[model samples]
Target: MHKKDNNIDIANDRNENIPTERISTMFSFGMGDFIYEVFNGIFGAFFFLYWETEVKLDIWIVTLAYVIFAIWNSANDPLIGYLTDRPNRFWKKYGKRFPMVMIGTVPAILTLAAIFSPPFLDPVQGAWIYFAWILITTCSYELFFTLSSLNHYALYPEKFKTDRQRRRAGGIRMALALVGTAIGFIVPPLLIEYENRASYTNMVWIFVIFNLIFFLSLIPGHRESNYLKKRYMKEKEEQKEQISFWDSIRIVLRHKNFLVVILIFFLDSIIGVSLTASVQYVAKYVLEAEAETSIYILAGFILGALISLGPWLFFSEKINDNRRMLIIGVFLNTIFLLPFMFANDLFWLVIAAVLLGIGGGALRIGRNPVMADAIDEATLNSKRHLEGAFMGVYTFFNRFALIAQGIIFAVVHELTGFNANLPNQTELAKFGIRLHTALIPMILTLIGLIIFFRVYDLFPEKTAKIKQKLKELKL
Candidate 1:
């Protein structure tokens, strides 16, 4: 899978325009995102049980309630993407992302507080409260999430001028993001053990407290990119002023290459969402590893985060190629998954986790830069202001992947009767959980290649043309 050269060298000869310090600060956005993911992913995994199992709502009501909250969250993703990019949006203004992010925090926290605050009534009354709180949190969370994420990603082109720079920056961001994600996933299960050995409310508080703290870090350090910098100047009178909002969006949707990214990324994301949602089930059932599985994922996340640094330091510096490296990583992920299908013991499962770590590490480092390269390529063709629209569309495509994943989970949960608080499920139910976790993710990794192969040679020269024009416009 590893090759000597990539399909494109979008910045092979460009001087390193992004300093290490700026990259470090720029990557701080990951800290915010990582916090969000940890809370969002973990809460999604366990909150239903917090309602039906611990809070003890009726199964029929809780099931439908969870579905209602889920659809509410999923439906808002595209809108979040679309609106976060609106240049004229003027409520609270640091820039496009920060305003949306700032505004979103209040609703998100309120919703979360409502979620954890137990309502006192019979099942019917409780269901309505649950629906209202969860749905609101879901909506606010989606807004907070997409806005922060799009703003974070938008910083890339503004701060970094070359492909290598983008990759290295991405590596740092993922490494930190993984650290936050690992802490989010690993700590709660181990640290917040129940006094009664079953009470989950304590754990929910633990999750919520950290989530709040995660956002606080951003308040002090989070600054928006300057849209009117000399470094960011545009040469063409048409390109100098940001393209009109509608025009900007039209450019993104019209690009065919961008479409391929959307297709493959969504497929890959469906697998991601399914595996993440099923992590608890797989750990408890298929691997039969219990708490060890969470530990296993944490270990994998840490290793993956660390491993990403090596490529930025070594291969990204030495080789002008990433396509082959990405392919190598994808297959590494594929190979790692193979072990899970055959793994009969925890020892072998650990090995599979490590391999996944390595594979995921490489993918994390390069993934965003590839998109950035694609965006650069699309801009050359469209010649309109497109970063926001691209970010918006990218958000839409990825969130839909999460939505697809939720569907997978819903189907698999029903299929397997994944009884959240039930003492034990049937052997057949456990097998279905295994299939959800293993086979589906493996399939998606293989399918990712199809989208990648369609890359139509986005070399550095192409980006240089855009950069040169941007420079001339500035002068």
Candidate 2:
């Protein structure tokens, strides 16, 4: 027997209740965030600087290389998602997402190491070589990164079915992410000096080791049950809907609510990268401080984010409105950015970091749940569990942040006449760093918040109905 509504199919052959996952399972899943943030935070914070300043590549060459990397990185994600979402031998044996995640893990870390291990060559003479190395290594890193992260993200909606569960898991993930980000930000400066290229390589090795050790936690989280596997296979057999790659992409693009989430996320990615990437410049030129000062500044931000997590989660749970929570987050973030832009001294800068952290914590708290809400609605509409494709497309847009940041930095530096070789940059250069870090991000975030407020109509009531529909459809 089957039920049909609005030309949609609902299976009656099998119905499985959503499992109540153990705290340990949640922790293991959350560990993936830690690993992801640790790598991402470091990369965002230092990768461009390493090439532009330390390697002495021409800014234009570095920018061009990143543009190429961005193109490959952003374009591959949706394809990866579509490819992996299909039924396969691995899906039947080891589980649907686990093998794919494992395949991507080691290679991703290796390539991340290779990014800092560029061949010793003259920056101007071997500019193309340097550009090629960056383009290849970074794109390679993102290839495996997309593979692992897309599956990890896909699992969230599948594994945690309830709003309460999503909130709990999301909170844990954000908390761990901040800790990983702290490690990424704090440890690099402790190990690296501006003049020493070898120190950067050493820092990469340390992160590589740390990430491998922590990746074990992901194993337990990725475990799939016989029931889940059977259900997945059964659905694949029953639906028999042949969704092509372009069709999948088309469906994802046409989802209005999903597009809103994707756009907001895209803007947020730029904000995050711009702020993180500028910290070293801020510490170096703006504050006229040693490399270690970067640690203190990052610490202030991390500590602020850490301390505010509890309150943000608490209030978000009370509100039970992911949309409202995200709105509040954006508003808070916009307000907090001004202090950092104006602060000249270490004390004031750290104070600003704290305020930014509070706002950041709020944003993190709401981001995933709202995203999950969007995913739930999409699944309900598509009548298929296409979380992988959805997440892939989301990441597809998200990776363009790299390209956007590349353009922003190139334009700003060129216009400001910022010279990386100088020990002390001009006042214009310092202002350029400030513009990317605070002012521009603030403006983009404000625009995103406004658009999100206007277009995102998946309010609590609507989301609840979507969930109910999904339940009825057994997706």
Candidate 3:
């Protein structure tokens, strides 16, 4: 059964059941977030360079490890989403999400560190170390990331059962998160002086400390569940069956829009590569600013945070009606990105960064809440709570983009023979440095816009009507 989509007349909805204090939890996540994403950028963008230059890992091994992680991350993303969403037995003694959240942090931090490391001491020794960390860290990352977020976000209904209220809450939280990223993106530029990349331990420790704050601060107001126990007790009297894994997939596939949404997410992520990877690329080639990329990247996130913190509170988002917001946002962002190729001045770069920030802001503010509304639409009609399954499907779709970026980046570097530390390389290697940051990401974003417009409904009016009807059905 879908449960209640609009519990308006029930006198007490899930949102009302949530304790008033949970609202404060949102602020905790923002304090140092951009740092982790920035860290990821450094790790992802420069791990190859780091390995190539500092630790001197084999390119073949590095490339292979990238492939392994790409494939692994894709498969694991939704698998865990599915597991976490389902009513589970693990939540019993484990105290719902707390145990999962607790277990995940250990590996997440460790794996994050490992992702940048050499495999072992010698070529073979380094390879072994790298591979070991990769596998352990990957699992830890997925488990904790999914566990913590799923538990945290699952509170949306509990926080505000009304559609409009949910959107508002989501918007506020997301805005804070972006701002946190902004803070995260802004400060690190000063800490990291990449000419001394070999001795960036100070910068690394700084990030680790902030991330620890993010990790530890989460404990305060997060809600718990005897949810597993509740599920078991309820299911015994209700369906008396666990959803088969195959049944779960079948249910998601049956929802046409749900499947389409997954495609949209995958497409978004792919095109997103251009946007996400651009900071590092632009800094190197255009600004000749290496680690200082964090400054500009934070600038974009801050811009996005300010602009995006708007629209999430309404039951219906207007973007679907005109979609000028997304289309124009992305178009301007792309046009601005192209300028890096021709513009010689820093002013143009700043302007372009701001433009990309606008589009990026729209994306941040709009994407997830819309997905939630769409899933609600599906549930009210299909009469099944399909959130877990849809997330699973979407995670599966995202892997391709991840793999494509890795391969493309590797090829580009190999071809350019991009010197990580060019003491006195010619102007061409300098160009190679620039290409590392932007060339591919720009192309990816353009294609992403085309894909998003082609397949997605900007705002389905049906989303509103379904919630309305569910109010009548008490579902």
Per-residue alpha-carbon lDDT of candidate 2 for residues 375-410, written as tens digits (9 for 90 to 100): 888888877788889998998899888899999999
lDDT at residue 467 of model 3 (Cα atoms): 65
TM-score of 1: 0.80
The lDDT, on a scale of 0 to 1, for candidate 2 is 0.86
Report each candidate's C-alpha RMSD, comma-separated, in the order given.
6.6, 4.7, 5.2
- The deviation in Å at residue 442 for candidate 2 is 1.1
> lDDT of candidate 1 vs native?
0.58
Residue-pair clashes per candidate: 5, 0, 16
lDDT against the true structure, per candidate, is: 0.58, 0.86, 0.54
Which runs in model 3 stand beyond 4 Å of their true positions? 1-46, 58-60, 89-99, 117-139, 150-160, 195-198, 224-237, 271-278, 281-286, 304-336, 421-439, 458-460, 472-475
List the lowest-lDDT window of 10 residues for candidate 1: 1-10
- If both were scored by TM-score, which would come out higher, candidate 1 or candidate 2? 2
Indicate which candidate wins on lDDT.
2
Q: In angstroms, how far off is 131's CA in candidate 1?
A: 3.9
TM-score of every model?
A: 0.80, 0.95, 0.78
State residue 453's C-alpha deviation in candidate 1, in Å: 1.1
- Candidate 2 stretches greater than 4 Å from native: 1-16
Scanning candidate 2 in windows of ten residues, the lowest lDDT window is 5-14
